[model samples]
Target: MSVYARRRRRSGTLMELVLTFVALGLLALLTLSGIARQSAGEPILPWIQPSSGNHLPHGVNYQIDALDPTTLAPMATLPQKGMVELRLAVTNDSALPVTFSFPTSMQCEFVARKVHTYVGGLFVLPLEVWRSSYFHNVSRHASRLTLNPAQTKVYVANWTLDPFDTGEASAGTYQVSASFGKSTIPLHIDKPL
Candidate 1:
């Protein structure tokens, strides 16, 4: 073969190899992107089987329960200054499947007592709402969760409480609650030690 023709063939082969590699690289990139979108932190989450509840006569029935995070035990009272977790378990009582949307952050507040005291001089503090900083800047995206008939789903939310404005971390009973829609779970908190 002529030198000119040989050089042309070699150039064409190199161009073909480059184009092939470019196409393969793009295909790999597309595949990796799809995998990344589907994998939402699988390393942190364990697989949980769906549990079914008994069919009820009413529609969706929701029960809110307070639990201690450290022990995973049910709680009736919490400490004055610590994290409180409220689990809202919703049972689909109707025959139809229901979809509910709730924010990732939970809304909660504290209610203090107002009484006539000789030492504290009529100590009465107004209600204090615990603010969550999770979705402060970005607009919160509500999660659309669905529950089939007779299926129960429990959602957990936590709130950390601080002392009163007057630094009155005194020994007194207070009420704290987490509310979702019209349903709420009210629990008492003992005085901070």
Candidate 2:
């Protein structure tokens, strides 16, 4: 073959290869942009709906049911063999679906603080008579639960303790509260004799 002809053929092949790469690069850019547009406002997990940041929907109803028996029964001995079921009923009142974003596997935490009379409401002893975090064994995962309109889901935790009281350790007025849904219920426990 002539040198000029051979040179022309090599140049043609080089130009074709360069043009092919440019076309592929443009195609790749278009494909990635389309995907980005589809996922603009969505989280990584599209199936799991995300709630408003750190705030539950205003219309959603999340409340603890009335405590059974309404009063703490005095314990006859220490470490009473009893249990209380803490039930949280979450209802979606809005027309749209509501999502609960739990950073941990625990949906909520129950806490009890002893209120001392010596200080006359000025001093509250930080004592937890019962805690679901220690007693409840649930699979740990950062998860989300979505509820449709008018749907209610109840989460229950079985706390092993006397109603409103655990034992000698729980004698006194307790300012009780749940970490989730935000509620406070005062409970009185008679001092053990």
Candidate 3:
């Protein structure tokens, strides 16, 4: 082959090598971007299942119960301007005492007014309401609590109803639900009188 022809062929091969490297680098960059986007995407959280009388590994048992106002005062008619009491039972099913730190709000399928009160222990305190602009002025509060094994503590929740508030809704039957962790209990609030 002629010297000029051979040099021309070599130059062409070098150009092809450079282009190939550039293309490979761009592909690597795109793949890295895609992976970063996938990681930044929202994470799927596992659903929390209800406890089937099984104690948590920490030996803590969380439960919710409704205190029938009827037994005390006919369940407080809607717009009656009174308090509906709820009892939350925390028991240590393990062999040792366990301390529980309460969370601010529990996830649920619906919305309603809520308040928390710790009772029957050293952490006894007044009721605290979960306050929001969507609802009336109420303070939602919680306190750290501890329980001994086989010991059960009751936390009282007082849900206040304003006869005039009616939750800004027209007169109708409304289902009020309150939840603590995985435990939820609902109450029926009839429309205003």
- The top-ranked prediction according to TM-score is 2
Which candidate do you rate higher for TM-score, 1 or 2? 2
- Model 3 — which ten-residue stretch has the worst lDDT? 116-125
Q: Which sequence of candidate numbers ranks them by lDDT, best first?
A: 2, 1, 3
- Candidate 1 collision pairs: none
Candidates, ranked, TM-score: 2, 1, 3
Candidate 2 per-residue C-alpha lDDT over 93-150 given as tens digits, one digit per residue, 9 for 90 to 100: 9999987777677766666545443223222234556666775677767877788999
Backbone clashes, each candidate: 0, 0, 4
1 or 2, which is superior by lDDT? 2
User: Where does candidate 2 stray beyond 4 Å?
Assistant: 1-55, 69-81, 135-140, 162-166, 181-193
lDDT, candidate 3, residue 184? 45
lDDT of 3: 0.48
Residue 50 CA displacement from its true place in model 2, Å: 30
> lDDT of model 2 at residue 53?
24
Model 1, residue 27: distance off in Å is 77
- Model-by-model lDDT, in order? 0.53, 0.55, 0.48
Worst 10 residues of 1 by lDDT: 37-46
